[model samples]
Target: MLAGLQNVTFEFGARTIVEDATWHIHPNERIGLIGYNGTGKSTLLKLFAGEYAPSAGTVERSRSTSIGYLHQDLLSFDTNESILQVALHAFDKAKKIERELEEITKKLEEHTTDELLHAYSEKLHEYEEAGGYTIEHRTEEVLQGLGFSNSDLKRPYREFSGGWRMRVLLAKMILQQPDLLLLDEPTNHLDLPSIEWLEKYLQHYKGAVIIVSHDKYFLNRMVKKIVELYQRELHIYNGNYDFYEVEKQQRVELQQRAFENQQDYIRQQERFVERFKAKASKAAQAQSIQKRLDKLDRIEDVTIERPNIKINFNVDKTPGRVLVELKHVSKHFKNIDILEDASAEIDRGDKIALIGANGKGKSTLLRILAGAEPFEGERKWGHNVDDAFYAQHQLEALNINNTILDEMKEAGSKKTELELRTLLGCFLFSGDDADKKIKVLSGGEKARVALAKTMISKANFLLLDEPTNHLDIHSNELLIDALNRYQGSLILVSHDRYFISKTANKIWEIVDKKIKVFKGTYEEWVEWKERAESRNQTLASGSAPVKEVIKETPKASSNGQPTTSTGGANAPINKEAQKELQKQQKMFQQLEKQLADLNKQKAELEAELSNPSTYADPEAFKKTENAYRQVKDKLASVNADYEKVFEKIMTLEEQQS
Candidate 1:
């Protein structure tokens, strides 16, 4: 075991995070530690990291084990060194050996002795063993993988923002390759591509990993096991997040059933005991029954663990056909070009998900749309378009001295106190929580409050950036449900794939200083992207793009009724197709036979060209090479023709069906 807890109990003052919880960490296990926000997920990670001691039981670890913990607190590490240098520090032994090696080289240049030479040789070997020669290369690779540019690598680490700083620390943690890795909300600081990169990296990671994240998609794809902290206990699920969801529901249902049955039995026994206690003969029996009832291990009734709050968005105004339009939009920051001559439109019902890697200007473009940032662009809002923008920075707009309820009142939403309190409850501020001053709220709480304010704005258009970052999985579901029922248009920037999939009907991505639009759902967009990649790979392999063949069919009637080729004939079309289909089928078969023959000839010629003995005979070799080139060209030609005919047949078959 790298590190684990055995019947551990943890508490903060009077609040118990966990009680008698046992979880063993094995090598190479990819685990997702999950729970609702404020459920002490981070505190649990700290327990494993030795940042906090368990109130009871033991935290065990192997003597040789090394751990790497990546959390938001690591952002406090200020450094002027280049990010590359900071990442290279992961190689502690290699760096120390490198310093000794440098000193030895300088000393050897002035005075050479057998002892000095011997020491230098020994240090060189140690450096090599410690991967000293390739440390910089490895560090650069890891940094770039986490979304750092080559130029950014040389900049001072302190120059980067919090998110970037977190990424740099993450890269260092990854490079350290400890026996066990603990990450708290790692995806919170990453973009879609970086999250994907981290997922891929962790999938094949040599060490055990335990991630505390709210990203359902990330946890589903990245972890093989899930550990949920709930009700002062650790519940283990031997599968990914999706599996855990199903299993947890089933467990809840079963537990509820057991509790109901046990309650019924106790009630029946109580009634019998009351009826019999009055009789002298049955008094002893009633007493024994009472003792048995008292001694019985009772099952607690099932209750909802997550907050049960409804989120409903009401659009007060109906916008015009086009809610917002960007005409020849262009944005530039210093020497960096974000968008140039980009034109796009958000229609009245459009639900757009703007997604891509970080530094690709997603948030910047959102600001441009909100008119909060200066850029060279034409942003036009349609008639009756009342827009509300919510972002992380918008949290600053809250009045620190005001309570959460007061802050909502200042939104000018005109909601009654009960109504506003209900809204706050939706954001996890229930009962007296709304009375707490904003200054006492954590960053996540502030973000949630800001989101709730935007939701209650009664706007016809909404711009949300990272709305799910501060929300737990269940809260995200509530938000998705709210957005699904929303009657307004929205353009949101988010890295959560599950959120996007659930809420978006359109996708927008910034590509090479242009906004590329895809009129489809997130799932469809992903499938299209995969197909495009596959086609690109085919092109790289010297294959032309498949040519789609089109055939004109009988047009439908003006009233949208089906039309037949054989004018009003009572033909099933199946019969007609079967008759004409034979000819096409014959041609298709002939083409396949011809294609096979050509491939066989090409293979034979290529084999002959590959033989060394054939090269010894110049004339034969030249003839073989010529034949091979001819066959290769012929193969490409035939392949295209084959696809065209294949598509033609498929079209014909589908139409008949």
Candidate 2:
């Protein structure tokens, strides 16, 4: 085991957070730690990280086992140091060996002693083994994968935002390659691409990993086992998040049945003792029954509290066919252009999901659509379309001095006290909880309040940005169900794939300063993207080219459903189109070959130029350099042509479909 807790009991003063929780983290295990907010998930991680000593029992870590922990709050970095310098610190041991080798080399230059030479050789070997020479290259690759550019790497860490800084810290942790890695919501700040990159990295990671995350899709992809903290105890599941859900439900049901049966038996015995205890003839027997009843161990009922909040969008009226429309919209922040000429029409009942990388205008687009932000172009709302926008930052707009009930009353003044209380109860605010001051509420509680306000707005159209951000899994499920049952239209921006898949039918992907609309679910979009990538890879590697099959489109039946073609009427193929496709495929193959040959020549020239002997001959060096430059130019030209051809092929295929 890399680390484990032995009957760990932790508490603050009188209140207990965890009690006798024993958990063992084994080698090469990807374990996900899940629990509701304030359930000691983070505190448990700290105990494993040695940042906290268990109040009772012990936390045991194997001897000399290196642990790397990435907290939700990123560590501060040196303002004077560049991003690259901070990342390089992960290879401290390798750098130290490199420094020692440099000193030994200087000493050898002064006097060729055997001891100095031997020391230099040993240090050089150590440096190579530690990957000292290629540390900068690896750092660059990791930073780029984490959404950093070469220019960004040269800038100081303070130049980046908090979310970007978190990515840098995550990169450092991965590069350090400890024996065990403990990550707390690592995907919280990462965009889709960065999340995918991190997933691949962790899949190949040679260490045990324990993560606490609410991203169901991420947990499903990264973890093989789940350790859930519920009711101040640990429940281990031997499968992924989806599997755990099914298994947990079954276990709860079984436990509830067993508890009910035990309760029935106890009640019967109690009734028999109560009736006979007063009778003189059976007094001894009644005493024996009382003793047996007292000795019986009571079984607690299996009760999991679901979120009390009922989120139902109050749709007063249906809007026109087109709920909203944007025409040539463009948004710019100082020198950075986020959206350019983005135009789209949102019809009634269109459940659209806005997705993109961080700072890529997903939220900005939502703000623009909600008429809360200014843009360069026209935005129009359809007739009778009343819109309510739920920005993630809206939690800050809540009245801190007011109570939860007061805040809800402000948004929903028309709601009666009983109705409002019922609504608050659904959101887990009942009686005393409803009277709690907003200033004293936790982040998750504030989020819940904000969401309840939005749901009570009774708007026909909803624009939600990161609605699931601070929600626990159960709350997320409740929100998802609410959205699914919502009769009004919605445009949501969230990183939770599972929630999106369950709610969105249309996808508005903001990429490269433009919005691309796809008429399908998120899963369909993923499949299409994967197919496109596969085709691109085929083109790049000069693999077997995709054949252009001129099959007739299937005809619809009387019911307007597509029917399978078996000796059915064949549609005539356009001969010219067929020839053009073949020509394009052949050209793509030729360009791939040319690019491969040019790369080969370039590599050979680079190798020759690296040799010291080549520099001894000036003419040979000049010739090799010129040849290398020519090949490099040729390779670039071929790559450009190849990209154009590949795009053309993809377009044609898309059109055919």
Candidate 3:
């Protein structure tokens, strides 16, 4: 193993952030760290980076091994340094080695002594080992992979946005080729194409990697192992996020059973002691039993938390056809055209997704469509298409002094104060939190407030640009659910594949200075993309290979009626399969409702446990803890069941409709 931690413990004040956490990372291992906010994911990354030490136990690393870390808060650099110069800093040590080699070369040329010749040979060997010959090439390769074009290489760091500066730092980290790479939220500011490029580059990386991200799809694609921090304990699983989730559920079930067994044993011992305490003859036996109970290993009660978000859309009724039409639309900045003759027709109820490489005017086109920007060509809006746009830069556009309530009010929501507060609470803001100044809130909190405001708009046409930014996994899933059920037409730009897969009906890939519309769902697009890549590979290699495509077939309805689908005859659904799918979906919905109610009960129990008055009433506190554990165990089971059923429903529905 290149790195390992045993019985690691880290604490802040009386609160334990990590306790008895043990895990090992070997070279070539790709791991993802996942946990709730403030659960010490970033803190753990820092520990791995050597910036923080464990309060107890050892963090073992191979001798002479190097580590490269990219924190969420990117490092600052001199403004005068160009982007290329900043990236080149990764080779500072190698450059120095080369300089020493040159100095020795000059000295050896002047002095022909045997000692000098031997020293020069040793320096030359050191230079070669440090990759003296290809340092520049390696740096250039990393910079390009991170989406830095040739034109951007020489731009001063001060001229770049904070986001671009982050890219430069990322490039430096990649070029360093450390024994381990620790990246915290590396994809936060990356566009879809850039993210894809990074994924490919990381896939072939030779060193160990530990990434912290809430993007499930990204983690699933890139990681082989998952380490989850929960309740100040680290749970390590030998698989990606999806696999870890399944294994975690199983592990929690086992832990719950073990805890129950321990409790039963303890209860039996206590009863025996109480029964024998009155009789001196049984005192020895009771004492022995007490000792045995004390010696028994204690089981830690495992409680599972599900990724749940309360999401309900109040979108207006669907608008008329021809919701939006752009004819020969053109946009330019400083006489340089970003978009020219961009024309598209969006009908009512169309779930369109906008996709393109970075700096390809995807956001610009969304703004033009939303009427936030002016274009030269004719832009028509259908009657009843009341549009509400959630800009990608919505957080920056907010007034820092405005409260959450004020934003909603400005958005023309007439909801009662209590109702508005309840809505805000769903987004994790409540009481004083709802009244907190926007300036004091984090980026994520601000994004949630903005989303809450948008939800109150109830527009018939929604144009969202990267709306999933700064959102947790639960929130992302919630937004996807809302968009899936929304009555309005949606045109969204997002790098989140799962979101697009769940919500979009049509995809427009912006490439080669034009948008090419693909008439299918996200899954279909994936299939098409694979086939295209396979064909390209065959042509380049001068050989043809076997190709396979999983065709989606539509299914029949519950009453055995053939359901119509857009994919024509190719989309055929098996009736039996469809019925089974509907059955599972119904079960899932019922389980979700049950789980929600149980969670509410659990919260109430927790509140009772935390109350000082309840502690005074020991019986009540114990009862509340028991109730909380039971509810939590059941919630985890239901969540696992829900995921299984949801997957089945998707498979069956794809075949049916």
Candidate lDDT values, in order? 0.82, 0.80, 0.75
TM-score of each: 0.81, 0.84, 0.74
Off by over 4 Å in 3: 100-122, 257-307, 396-399, 405-432, 536-657
RMSD of each: 11.8, 6.0, 22.1
Arranged by TM-score, best first: 2, 1, 3
Cα lDDT tens digits, model 3, 241-311, are 88998998799899999999889989988999999977999999999998898888899897544435455
How far off is residue 626 in model 2, in Å? 19
Q: Candidate 1's error at 67, in angstroms?
A: 1.0
Q: Roughly what TM-score does model 2 have, to 2 decimal places?
A: 0.84
Off by over 4 Å in 2: 75-78, 278-281, 307-309, 394-396, 418-433, 439-447, 542-657
| Reference-based lDDT, residue 521, model 2 | 84
Model 3 residue 225 CA deviation (Å) reads: 1.4
lDDT of 1 by residue, 1-657 (tens): 788999999989999999999999999999999887778999999998889999999999898999999998888899899999888889988999989977976776676666776676677667767776567867887888889987899999999999999999998898899999999999998898888888888888999999998888999998989999988999999999999999999999999999999999999999999999999999999999999999999998888875567777777888899988888989988878999998888898999999999988999999989999987869997899999999998888989999999989998888799999877766778789999999999999999999999998899999999999888887888899899999999999999999999999888888768787777788887876675455433432223322211122222333211212222222245555544545555666677788899988976875564444554444564587678778778866876777776666555544442
- Among the numbered candidates, top lDDT falls to 1
How far is 333's C-alpha from truth in model 2 (Å)? Answer: 3.7
lDDT of 1 at 457: 87
The candidate that achieves the highest TM-score relative to the unseen native structure: 2
RMSD of model 2 against the true structure: 6.0
Q: In each prediction, how many residue pairs overlap at the backbone (N, C-alpha, C within less than 3 A)?
A: 0, 4, 10
- Residues 1-657 of candidate 2 have per-residue lDDT tens digits of 888999999997887889998888888999999988667899998998898898899999988899999996565554667888888889999999977866865665566665665565566567767877568878988998988977799998888877888888888888999999999998888888889888998999999999999899999999999999998899999999999999998998999999999988988988888898999998899999889888888888987655445666668888999998888999999968988887788999899998877768888889899998998999988999988888857778999999999998999548887888777765656678898999999877898788789988889899998887777787778788888999999999988888899999888887557777767788877875675576555543444433323232223323221112122235454456546665777888889789889978877886675554554444574688689779877876887799799877765543342
